[model samples]
Target: MKIAYFDNNATTRIDDLVLEAMLPYLKEQYGNASSVQHKLGRQGSHAVEHARIQVAELIHANPKEITFTSGSTEAINTVLRGISKSYRTIGNRILTCGTEHKAVLTTCEQLTKEGMAIDLLKVNGLGEIDLQALEDAIGPETVLVCLMAANNETGVIHPLQEIAEICQRKGVLFFCDATQWIGKLPLNVEETPIDILCLSAHKMHGPKGIGALYIRRKSKPIQIPALISGGKQEHGLRGGTYPVHQIVGLGEAAHQAQQKFEIATLRDYFEAELLKAVEESSIPTKGANRLPNTSNVLIKHVKTAELMTKLPQVAFSSGSACVSGDRDPSHVLKAMGYSAEDAYCSMRFSFSKYTDREEVDSAIQQLKEAVAAIRAHSPIWEMYKDGLI
Candidate 1:
């Protein structure tokens, strides 16, 4: 069976160009980036620095501002841990929204155990943060405001600019997890006043296990002690031997993404095709201003897991890939005011520039068949049809 992949949000296939760019580093150029005397080490360091330039160019940031990491989760954890440790004397209070990924929520929970206060900002029914509530949440004791540029589950883009402005007015450092938004959407860090931003390489057709964090340079240079204590690396913020090949892959991927990011037309075609196939039922698209490549739809009367099982040829996800096994409904949908049932019935379909119109059509047909088959067996659908339980 030919498999149709619509789960780019979870992870993307590595681009051929990116792989090609990384071949030398993985094969002949293998050396420790920390080694200064050897030629091999210089080659590795050169590759890392070159990759840094690519990542920086993608976000319109200075290469000096980027710090390499394992992935978005680690980058986020680093920022959270670093900020909390550095600002604990002034304030131990952290603010985040209810719709954040497990990484952010779990990290905040860990901090709470260590005697820090955390405030979860509530969102409206559309999965948007309450701006007034965010404003009210920030106080002198608030040190950091954590938010995501786009939600992983719903594809809903947050009002980051407004939130950033709010944090700036309150003098609180703002951190944004731009993991889902970086490659799919256009971003300018300088224009958008953000203190810390996180990104992952795999989501943008780069190698897995490589990511970057953007730290705003301040007049006094806000220093957060190293997360991993070892040889000095990543400007002494993260101390470990760098992955040269993976960094090269990330850089190549970022360069490619910058060159070929035409998500709007492709996304529109997919959405139109899906709506055409399922005109009677509602397709739960994110509210205006979402990532162009994402589509979150609720197939009523069909369980998401059941649908997935029936449609084995297509690759999709019920929610964020990171929260796959949890029985609880998606916190993102819940924050959007979706009921438990609505959240459970929802499926996330994400596309990439590599996705074609034929693939979109194939996915729609498979989804329609899967929904029909599953709902036919569902007692809930039968009862609704006969008006009897």
Candidate 2:
């Protein structure tokens, strides 16, 4: 059977152009970026710098402001640890939303155990942070506010500008985890008042194990405590041997994304088709203002896991890959006021530029059939036939 991949949000296939760009580094150009005397080292350093520039250009930030790391998770951890350690003299409180990724939430939980006070901002029914609640949450003791540009599970874009303004007014450093939104949407650091932002290359058709963190020049660049303290690398924020090939791959991916991001229309077409099918079946699309490439749908009588198992040809997910094993309902859907049953029945379908119209149509057909089959097995459907649904 042919397979259809609609799980782009979990990870994307690396672009061919990006792989071509990284070939030399992985083969002939292999050298430690920290070496000063060797020609190989110089070449490696140059590649790393070039990748930094490409990433910085995408966000309209200076090349000097970018710091390479293993991935977004590490970048976030670096920022959180750095800020908490360096600025504990001023404040020990960090503000964030309840719907953040495990990276941010788990890091905050660890810091709380280390004696830092954490304030989790609540989101409204639409999976957005309550601005009034944010304003009320800020205080002199608040040192940082971390929020994601778009939610990983729900695909709902947060009001980063407004959140940034709030953080700016309160004199708290703001950090944005743009791992989900970076390549799919346009970003301008000058326009968005974010002080720091984290992005992963793999999310946008680049190699995994390489990402960058943007540090605003205007903000008092905090002396971040190093997470991996050994060699003096990444301006001492992170210390490890740099992966030049992966960095180059990330740069090439960013460049290609900048050039071909118009392919987002492919995702738009997928959404349109999926929504039409959902409407025909009387299924409700969850929430509003989701990303162009993502659709979270609730099939009333069908369980998400059962539906996916029944449709083996379709590649999709019930939620984020990180939390897939947990039997609990999605925290994001729960925060949006969805009951346990609705949350459990919802599944996410995320597309990419590489996805074509035919694949989308196939996915829709498979989904429709899957839902029908599952509902046929459901006792609720039988009850409905008996005038009890």
Candidate 3:
């Protein structure tokens, strides 16, 4: 069976061009970037700096502000931990929402144990926080505001410009997780007033285990301490030997995504056809501005796990790939006012530039068949049809 992949939001297949760019660094160019005394080492160092410039140009950021990390997880930890400590004397409070990624949510939760006040702003049914509520929440004790450019599961986009303005006017630092937003959408850090941001390469068709954190240095300088302590690397912010090959892959991927083709046309067609074929199916966040390549479909009464088990030819997700092993309902949907049953019945389908209409049609047919098969055996589905629930 030919498999159809709709899980690009979880992680994308590395582009061939990115892999080709990284080949030499993994083989002949294996010299350490920290070793500048030798010729090969200096060459490797130059390659790393070149890759940094490539990644920086993609987001219109200063190359000096970029700091490489293992992935967005590490970058998030570094920012949250470092800033919370650095600004502890200025303020004891951090503002964020419950619908954020686990990395941000978990780190903020942990900071509460260290005497930091963590306030979670509520999201509406559309997974959007009230701008007025956000502005009102910023007290003198608030040090930082954490938000994401786009949600990982639903792909609903937050108002970055407005949020940045709010944080700027309040004199609090704004940290955005652009992990799922950067490659899919255009971002100009110089135009926006964000204090810090994070992005992972794997989400944009690059190699895994390499990402970057953007720190504001010129306008409103932020003094954040190092998360990892050791040798001088990443401007003494993150220490250790650099992964030159992976960094090269990330840079190449960024270059490709900069010129990626339009994807919303395919995504819209997929959603329209699927909704027409599948009974009572609807998109939960249709009214919100979402990523062009993502659609979270709610197939009432058909469980996502059962749908996946029945149809193995298509790859999709119930929620974030990081917590796929957990059987609990999606926290994101739950935050959007969905019940556990509704959350269980929702499936996330994400696309990429490589995705074609034929693959989407095939996946839609498989989904229609699988959903019908599962709902046929469900007593709850029968009740829903009879209006007895």
Candidate 4:
């Protein structure tokens, strides 16, 4: 039995080119990137710098602005913690949205314990933030406003230009956890007025343990103190030896994604055809601007877990991969005004450029069968048959 993968929002399979590019670093070219004396060390250092250039191109940022870390989680921690410490004299409040990944939320929670005021901006029914509300949240004590470029679960895109303008007008630092698209979507940080940006490599077909944070180092240097201490690495922002293979893989992945970025309309067709076959199913945020490859689907009257279990060969997710083990309904869905039952019945299906029409068609068929098998056992389905719900 062949398996169908539709959980790309969680993580992507590393590209073949990325793996090929990492071979030398893992094998014969093993040397520390920080060592500048030996030939092997020079080779490793050169590769690391070249990878920085490649990754920088994806976001239209200066190579000097990028600081590589373990991944987005570390990158987020670094930015939040560094800013929390550096900006203590400047302000005490940090502004962010409610629908951010646990990474940003958890970091904010930590800062609150240290007496920083963490204010969560609310989103509308479609999982979108109110621009006016964002503007209202900024005050004299506002040090930073952290928002994601795209949601990880629902794929709803925030209006970056407008949000940037608000932050700029108020003279507050703007930080974006653009993990969803740092490796995939075309971004121009210079033109967008973003002060800081962070993203991971794994989301865009790169290695898992590598990521970068972009701090605008233009006219006046943006000050963010180092979170880790010891040796001088990542321009003294982060300390430790670089993971050579992972960094090389991330660079190759960024190059490949830039060269082969395909924005096809398969998601529309997938949702249309899937909805036609699977009656009463809904596409969350269907009326809003969402990522081209994501679909948060609600197959009403059928529990997503039971449906997934019935179709063992199909691989998807009930929510964000971070909360995969949690039995509670998705915090994102609940924030969008979905009832607990509706949230439990919803699953996220994502597609990559590699996802073909044949695979989507097969997944739809499997979904219909799974829904039928599970709904047959549901008391709610019986009530629906009697026009009770």
Best by TM-score: 3
Better of 1 and 2 by lDDT: 1
TM per candidate: 0.96, 0.94, 0.98, 0.97
Total backbone collisions for each predicted model = 0, 0, 0, 0
Q: Pick the candidate with the highest lDDT.
A: 3
Model 2 root mean square deviation, Cα atoms:
2.0
TM-score of 3: 0.98
lDDT tens digits by residue: candidate 3, 68-98:
9999999999989988898899999999998
Q: What's the true lDDT of residue 3 in model 3?
A: 91
lDDT by residue for model 1 over 153-250, one digit each (tens)?
Answer: 77889888898899889988999999999888778888998989999999999999999999988886765667777767987888888999999999
Per-residue lDDT of candidate 2, residues 71-114 (tens digit): 89999999998899988999999999888998999899999988
Error of 4 at 32 (Å): 1.0
Rank by TM-score, highest first: 3, 4, 1, 2
lDDT of 4: 0.87
Q: Compute the lDDT for candidate 2.
A: 0.84
